[model samples]
Target: MTLLAENYENDPIDVLVGDWMSEGNMTVRAGTKISGQVDAYEPTFLEALQPALPHIAKYRIKVAVNAGAADTKKLHEAVTKMVKGQGLNLSVAWISGDEVLPQLLEAQKRGESPFENICTGESLDDWDFEPIYAQAYLGGLGIAKAFEKGADIVVCGRVSDASPVIGAAYWWHNWQRSDLDELANAFVAGHLSECSSYSAGGNYTGFKDLEPLGWENIGYPIVEISHSGEVVVTKNKGSGGQISVNTLTSQFLYEIQGPWYFNSDVTAILDNISFEHLSTDRVALRGVKGALPPPTTKVGITAKPIYQAEMHWFMTGLDIPAKARMIETQIRMLLAPHLSAFSHLSFQIIGSVPDNPTNQNAATVDFRVIAQARRAEDLAPAKFVRPCIDPIMCAYPGATPHLDLRQAFPKDIFEYYVTLMPQSDIQHRVHLSSGESIEIAPPAESKVYSKHQPTQHTTGNVVDVGSFGATVPAPLGTIVHGRSGDKGSDCNVGFWVRHQDEYAWLQNLLSTSFVQSYLLGDEYRGGRVERFEFPGLKAVHFLLKDHLDRGVSCTSSVDFLGKNCAEFLRCRVVDVPLRFLARGRI
Candidate 1:
């Protein structure tokens, strides 16, 4: 609400939307619900909403959010009572019926299981983990229904992230389910705005360019949509931030797989998408197309605790690699007799010795020992760090550990299960404060639905090294701007140039094989990697399948979400044309 209030004061904002749910968050909420916590929803939302209630009521601004988590009805009641106490006449509505774990478990008991892992072809029962709670990804129709019934605020549980914008636009335009293109445009816009300040220079790779904008006071994005679904995205005036085609392109490619961005209501096709710069702070988005949504909705399932833990030790001075190896050998020897207690275990050496050091800490390297177990007694908090400490007295020279050693204790590791459920199984509803309710009908699957197909990437003709005239070996960042993020277990990277001439060269240079050779090499090889081009936006996008090590649940990778994947690729040395280099880069 801090940022939302800022935008509201700056512009005549009609609606405020917040997206506070993620895959991991669903697992946490499920645990809380099963544990019988009184308030299973987000606790901070009410505190944030309390200060903004007066402004919201005065301006007649509608608020929507998915902070309802596992209990939308509880959230609605709490917010309604708070509003009445403050002498505000605002109506609060909520959408529920997203929970489906009980039914799934009952079906499993009757030997009629329909749930299967989307990535792995294993049935739910075949997996070792047991689900606690499950919720299907709901659409925007319920939220729109609340708005039509004059709801001042509409809270939802596990709906799609773009549903807030989709619902608001649907109510404003009185759009039907057949309005696929308009819904697609709204879906894309909501995605652009959902992360708030991300579209306004937060987490940008080119951080140097945003320094002048007072990063401490960075503003969030506000999108203006026309009836035809065309949009102009901008930020609050007189605030700190920057908006450009490059920034918008980065947000568009975040966490997306292929060209079909699936939602409960529509599948937005990002092929040949274009963005036009209307002003320094505003850009026009167009050419977004759509198809009928898939028959199934995405669902998240949380399983029993797959508890794991780790301990870190820092080694300083020369021969860091040998020291790390010796430590690992000692720990392995100690734990060899107790192998049955652990399901998985590994030792990792992070960082490298500095060539020349100015301080002891600068030349230090870190050694980590991590273990996972199915039983809590097997990997208790006190026993987990015993192996690491047993060798400290006779360890390598200059061996030391961090002061905060509490992290060595075992912790609950929730397994995130990603699967899909038929749209007919989900029951979407709007519970109004005035004792009225609305039921949203499931969308009819199209008979001629377009199969979600990825854009065919082309490996353009390779150019001879000497043909492009004088060249200099420099980081790819010298020629392009890029961003990367995670989508389930996959990582997506999109790199774009500021000039039209650079597009052709970029397309030819960054092919699927070229990227794999530069980044992954022979490590963790063998996965479906794809490359795509957006000529209108002058960008190249890549999706690396199963790159996040099981989607951050059990990944041992340093950069789990692949947020720095593009930055890693950007630092790769490339031969750049002297003409483009002379023009200067971001």
Candidate 2:
């Protein structure tokens, strides 16, 4: 590789390959503590290496992987394994540019800007840094490290999605670290390609019903970038996604906090770029202007994190037409009075009959109430509601006792959106291999980052079993009889929950006749209480094999369960806490 004054001037690099978003990142709740370990995951080193593919031989690549673990040991192990799996005979290792840990603490020290630490407020020194798992959304500097290391492929976790593109932009354009405007343009590039398809044309308003674009094969957003910071969003040969003005318009909606947010030692003037529709799945980007970033890079940090408290209570009730009405009234009069002191309030009617597009007037509704305050103790004074269920029901004034409410009530307790931001001057290092070269081609499969696939199609069926609160749920499930019969994967199992002293009751019942049982048990029971048969209740678990998918069946891969399992922890099931129960009209 020879140095050239015009490297970025003309005949710019033909292809810049990069990967983003490793694996799991479900931030835990931040209690009184400011810096604690959270469950974070990025693609294993092997997974990251796979993306580099056979192209390792010819081109200079940057394989960026986000070490997003607060646990440095695990993070490093995964990264090391990734490279070792490639036999270390590969190319560049341009780890993620996002510097999550130390920068966060540094930001806490500076107090310049609040850190978007993924969770709540965090102080740098107090944080448990995972060198292997830590990610900083570091932008140019992070990916530039890989370029510096001579890596051709950049792999990262939780990068602003645009960090890779921006890093490449900065490198290819030869845009100096002092150039804020150019750096920002590079930032835009990364953002455009982050969601893959959104930029290439997944969920564009102009092409809502893309007739010719078969969404199943919708390719993720890819960019034909210019050294001058100009770019064209596109995808692989004959992929399903569209790349029109519509797609570009949709994917751009994220990451850009207009007047825009310029990250860490870098900033940009967002309005300078021009978007043009070239052809299907091809959108051209022009007139991207940028400037030198602010001196200090804003860092995001989270306080000591705590697991989100999840509590599920299920109580069944039946009363043809009046069930919905009675439950509403009871909650308003009984539950509401007690829970109003909290932060959020949710009420849903889950049952055979529809709720949203109310189908039959005959279906009975399942009254589900979800409420969350600051902390467990934030609503501590009101914590009395958990135990008040039986007593309150026994004293019901209704002709039918709401007391014998056969169903269970499950409420997951988690704070909605609590994150922080900080700043730092962390210099990242990218590793380039001095080993044998490997040939590779463009990213052709697993086209995930496209906006043209599916949009907010479901209105969140207000009637059936929907998420308790906070807009979307991980794997959307539906009632088998209605919407999701064969659309995805659904499995029916007798669902059961442990209440008061029902542990022995459940064990005795399970010991009878159970097949392939999976219990939602705790420390006492190895969560192996697979055999569940609640005396008066019924629970079934369903998986939308491709519930959140189009072409691929998640089960096709052994890691599929692990993929969504992470999402499950943060997700609510069938208006309950069943890890696998699903709902919807399919």
Candidate 3:
């Protein structure tokens, strides 16, 4: 809400769109409802809207959000009551019918095969878990319908992240569903804006260049979609953020699986994108192609929860590596007595001592032991805590466990299941402020799109790195910028250079083999490495297969969402051109 107000402070914002429901968050909400919570909708929407209520009417700003989560009707009622209580005449609407757990279970009972996991090709029966919540990803038609009914605020359950922008554009232009080109453009705009400050320099790999923008109050993004599908992405003037080709390009590649970005409404083919610099803090995007959407919609299901617990031990002062190994040996010996009690257990030593460390904390090593079990009682804190504490007397010198024993307590871990369901089976609707309801019919059946191939970018002329004169071993950030994110278990990192002349060298230097070499050897080299390119943007993108173990809900990786993949890659030492390093402030 504070960010929204900052956006409107300079000029009135015509529309506001927010995406509060992520894969893990949806599962969390489902657990809440399964535990018998009547109103399990997200409350953060109201928390944000309360402060914006005053300016909403004053600026005539319309708001749309996926804050409805799994309970659209309840959220609608809550927002309506809040609006009325404030004596504000705001028209509100909610899009419903994303939940489909009952429908799916019934279908299975009728002898239908279980849904297959899109990434792993595993059927529902293959999972050793039971479904607790199942919801399909809805599109923008319902939101457009609500806007047509004069809704000032639109709330939705499980809509695609980009649906709000598509809906807003549809309402403003009164576009038909067949407006593929225009819708595709709006889709790109929404994708760029969906992550808020991401499109306006937050989390950008080029933060060194954005230092002048005063990131303490980084501005959120504002996209203006023209009638012909052209988009100008910018932030409020004088706000503390940057909107540049690099910033927007970083967002453009965020979380995308391939050249094809699938939404419930359309398949946006981002193979060939063109950008025009409209002005400072603004760029125009064009040439994005679109195709018919798949006959099925993606669904996220939360399965029965498992119990997990962790114990952290610190090895201080001398011989850190040996100390860590000694502690691990003793702990494993202690746990060997009850090995069968745990379904999974791993010991990891994460921190390392620096050369001639000046402080004890710097020289200290952090060793973590994480365990998972089927039963909560099997993972009781005492089972691990007692064994861990008993080692202090005979353990390495100055060995100590974490003071906060709360980390030892077992916690429920939810599993995220991704699958597809036929769109025709869903019953979608829109509820208006005037108590009128409208049914949203499913789209005509269409063939599902086949997998997309990466765009083959021509690497202009093969430039020799030696021609750039002297070189320096520096972080990759000194010469290039990129963004990284996850789609299912895969990790994608897109790197780009600012100058066109450097593209050839960048393409040559960032091959799969080169990337694996910098990953600290084979431990990070388990997956297949695929690379793609966007010459127009001077970017090379790499996708590491199954790098996350599983998606966020179940991944044991420290960086579950893969947001750190690119940053880690950026820190890897590379032979950077002396000229580029001279220009860099890092």
All candidates: CA RMSD in angstroms? 2.3, 19.2, 2.5
Residues 35-65 of candidate 3 have per-residue lDDT tens digits of: 8656778898899999888888777788899
Q: Give the whole-model CA lDDT for all candidates, comma-separated.
A: 0.80, 0.40, 0.81
Error of 1 at 235 (Å): 0.9
lDDT of 2 by residue, 203-291 (tens): 44333355567767666555666665566767665557677654564455432323334555455544444577677556776555654
Q: Estimated TM-score per prediction? A: 0.94, 0.53, 0.93
Over 1-586, each residue of candidate 1 has an lDDT whose tens digit, in order, gives 6456645655778989889887767777777787885677887889889988888888789999998898878888899989999999998999987898876677678876557666544578777887788888888889999999989999999988899999999898899898999999999999999997888888777667888887887787898888888889998777686877877888887877767788988888888788888878899998899789887777888887777778899988888878988888887877776668898888888777778899877888788888888876777754567876688877888777665767677777777777777677677788888888777877886423433336545645455545667888999988888888875667888888988667777878787777777655544467777777777888888887767766666566667778988887887789888888988877
Candidate 3, residue 487: lDDT: 68
Superposed on all Cα atoms, model 3 deviates from the true structure by an RMSD in Å of 2.5
The Cα RMSD of model 1 versus the native structure comes to 2.3
Candidate whose TM-score is highest: 1
How many backbone clashes can be found in candidate 1?
0
Give the number of the best model, judged by lDDT.
Answer: 3
Q: Once superposed on the true structure, which residue ranges of model 3 sit more than 4 Å away at CA?
A: 2-9, 107-114, 445-447, 452-472, 516-520, 523-525
Least accurate 10 contiguous residues by lDDT in model 1 = 446-455
The list of candidate 1 runs beyond 4 A from truth reads: 6-10, 105-114, 447-457, 460-467
Q: Native-vs-model 2 lDDT?
A: 0.40
